[model samples]
Target: MITKIAQIEILPGQEDAFEKAVTEALPLFLAADGCDGVDLQRSVEHPSRYRLMVRWETVKHHTVTFRASDAFTRWRALAGPHFAAPPKVEHVYPVLAH
Candidate 1:
């Protein structure tokens, strides 16, 4: 599997709203094809920073398939407004895990 990590910075004062929006959009990721799991984490030192992690069967599952779907549009609609800047995204393969 591959994991997609998106580092997002929310607009000041919009942190709570951003988190709520992401939580409300969980089903979009869960129901996506080839999606294995999804998680969101906030940085304690940077309250406006968030990391969105999604596990997929392959890189294409996220970049090609999901990005082309209506769900992608919906996701952006829900969360885009809170963004301070476009997110930085990357994919990683597991090196070791329990």
Candidate 2:
């Protein structure tokens, strides 16, 4: 599996609403064709920051399939407005040893 991490920084007071939107959109990720699972993490030191981790059967599933689908638009509709800036997204493979 490949893991895609999106580092998000929301506007100072938007965290609550952002989390709510993400919660409502959780099933969208799970229902995607090649998605395995996903999780959202909040920083204790920086409450306005979030890390969205999504696991996919392959990188193409995220980069191509999901990104090109209506679900992506829906996700962006919910989460995009709260973004302090464009998210930093990347895909990585498990090291296993680490």
Candidate 3:
């Protein structure tokens, strides 16, 4: 599986609204093609900073398929306004525990 992480920094004082929006948009992420799951996590040291973690079956499932679909448009519409800047996103694979 591929893990996609989006590093987002919210606008000042918009944390609550942003969180609510993200919660409401969870289904969009889940409904994407090859999507496994997604999690929105807030930073303890930086209240306005968030990391959006999404698991997909492949990197292209997220980068190409999802990004080209309406869900991506909807996702941006929901969370784009609150962003301090465009998110820094990347995909990764899990490391072996052993």
Range of the 10 consecutive residues with the lowest summed lDDT in candidate 3 = 89-98
Candidate 2 minimal-lDDT segment of 10 residues: 89-98
Estimate the TM-score of every prediction. 0.97, 0.96, 0.96
Which numbered prediction scores highest in lDDT against the true structure?
1
Deviation of model 2 at 80, angstroms:
0.5
State which candidate has the highest TM-score.
1
Model 2: CA > 4 A from native: none
Candidate scoring better on TM-score of 1 and 2: 1
Give the per-residue lDDT of model 3 (tens digit) for 1-90. 989999999999999999998998899989899999998899999999999999999999998999999988988899899999999999
How does residue 69 of candidate 1 score in lDDT?
Answer: 95
Which pairs clash in model 2?
A: none
lDDT at position 35, candidate 2 = 97
Residue 23's lDDT in candidate 1: 88
Sort every candidate by TM-score, greatest first: 1, 2, 3
lDDT string for model 2 (1-98, tens) is 99999999999999999999999889899999899999999999999999999999999999999999999999999999999999999999988854
